[model samples]
Every structure is written in structure tokens, then in C-alpha cells.
Target: MRMQVDDLSDERVQALIMNHLESMALHSPPESRHALHFDGLRQPDVTFWSAWEGEELVGCGALKELGAAHGEIKSMKTDPRHVRKGVARQVLAHIIDVAKERGYTRLSLETGSMAAFAPARRLYESFGFTYCEPFAHYKHDPNSMFMTKEL
Candidate 1:
């Protein structure tokens, strides 16, 4: 698979993002749904990436600059058809590498606390992220699990 820094205007990338958001909404409660919509992903603070296998989009993820020295992971999703094929792992590893390259001291993320999100939490744990309090505009919520890793 090829991982590319994507322009948000690219049609294929946009489609992949839309698919991710829809999937999130389906599996996550409204209160726990943190996935960004298309316009949100295009914000100035966010850098997005897409993974492709041949001409097909396999997965995508984004990194959001929260402030000095901190970065937030966002919009991480693998195409359902490609789940368990290491697509999410590849995208996440790439995002972490990019965060380190950009001089970020820490990386944090907010994911659902529901059983449906077990795989996501496991993935972060495998990468050395540990449970933490909310780090950004997020407040205490039972529906959310916050994790952070020092780079």
C-alpha cells in the first residue's frame, strides 16, 4: 500500500473520509461520535493522509496540531472490506512518524469507550498509548476514552 499526504480537495480522499464518518456514526453513539465531517477535516490545523492499494483507497487518518508540542490523532479508519489487513496499523504508524518528524512531544487521541471500539483501543495500546484525562477542548465523558503517548 502507498501512503500519501493528501490534499483535502482530492475526490478519492474526500470519498474515503465520508465513508469513515458514516461508519463511525453507525457504530458510535451520537454523544461519542468525534469523527470530523468533511469541512472540519479541511481545517487549517489538520493534516490528512490517505492509503491506497493500486487505485483503491484502503484507509486514511489525520493529525491535528492541538498546540505547541502536542498533536491529536483523528479520522482513523480502514475500509471495512480491508479491516484486519493491517491498513489501520500502517496509517497509524505513518501518522506517529509524521508527528515525531514535526517535533511533537506527545500524541493524544479520543476514541469511544464502547465495546465496538475495542479494536481501536487495542491498536493504540499496542503503540504504547496509555489512558489519560482529556487533553483538548474535551471534557469528562464516560462515553470517551482518552489516550496519550510521549514521543
Candidate 2:
């Protein structure tokens, strides 16, 4: 798959993001659903990427600079048809590479704690992201699990 920085304007990318948001809503309450919307991903501190295989969109992920040395992973989603095909893993690896290139000392992420998010948790764990307390503006929440990895 080819990974590229995205402007989030393509209808295909927009549809994937909408699906990501809707899926999060089903698994977490509104207050606990931290997945960013399209506009949120466009923030100055955030860098978004999309994975593609020719004409098909495979997955997407984003990195948000929380501070000069700390970064947060956001908006990771794989196309339903491409799950278990390594789309997410490749996209995540790309994000980590970009974070390292940006000189971040630590990378963290927030994901749902429910069963619906087990695969996501495992994915992060495979990337060496271990459990941690909520970072940045996040607070205590039973439904949220925070993970971090030192670069």
C-alpha cells in the first residue's frame, strides 16, 4: 500500500473518517469518544495520512503534536474490507516514523477500553505502547485506556 499525507478533502477519505466516527460512537459514549472529526484532524498541530492501494483507500491515521517533545496518535482506522490485511499496521508504522522524524520524545494515544476496542489495544501493544495515565488534556475516565511509547 502507498501512504501519503492527506488533505482530508477526498470523498473516499471523508467517508472512511465518518465511518470511523460512527463506529466509535457505537462503542463509547459521546463524552468518551475521543476520535477526531475531519476538521479536528486539520488542526495545525496534526498530520494526517492515508493508505491506498491503487484506486482503493485502505486505511488512515494521524499524529498530533501535543507539545514540543510529546505527540499523540489519533484517528486510526482500517477499511472494513481490508481488516487483518496489515493496513492499520503499515499506517501506524508510518505515523511512528513521522513522529520520530519530528523529534518527539514520547508518543501516546487514547483508545476505548471496551471489548470492541480489543484489537486496537493489541495493535498498540504490538508497537510497544504500554498502559499509562491519561496525558495532555485528558482526564480520568473508566472507558478510556491510555498508552505510550518512548522514542
Please report, in order, the local distance difference test score of every candidate based on alpha carbons: 0.90, 0.95
Per residue, candidate 2 scores C-alpha lDDT tens digits across 5-110 of: 9999999999999999999989899999899998899999999999999989999999999999899999999999999999999999998998999899999999
* Clash-forming residue pairs, model 1: none
RMSD of 2: 0.6
> Which stretches of candidate 1 lie above 4 Å from their native place?
none
lDDT of 1 by residue, 43-65 (tens): 99998888999999899999999
Instruction: Tell me the TM-score of each prediction against the true structure.
Output: 0.94, 0.99
User: How many clashes show up per model?
Assistant: 0, 0
Give the per-residue Cα lDDT of candidate 2 at 121.
Answer: 97
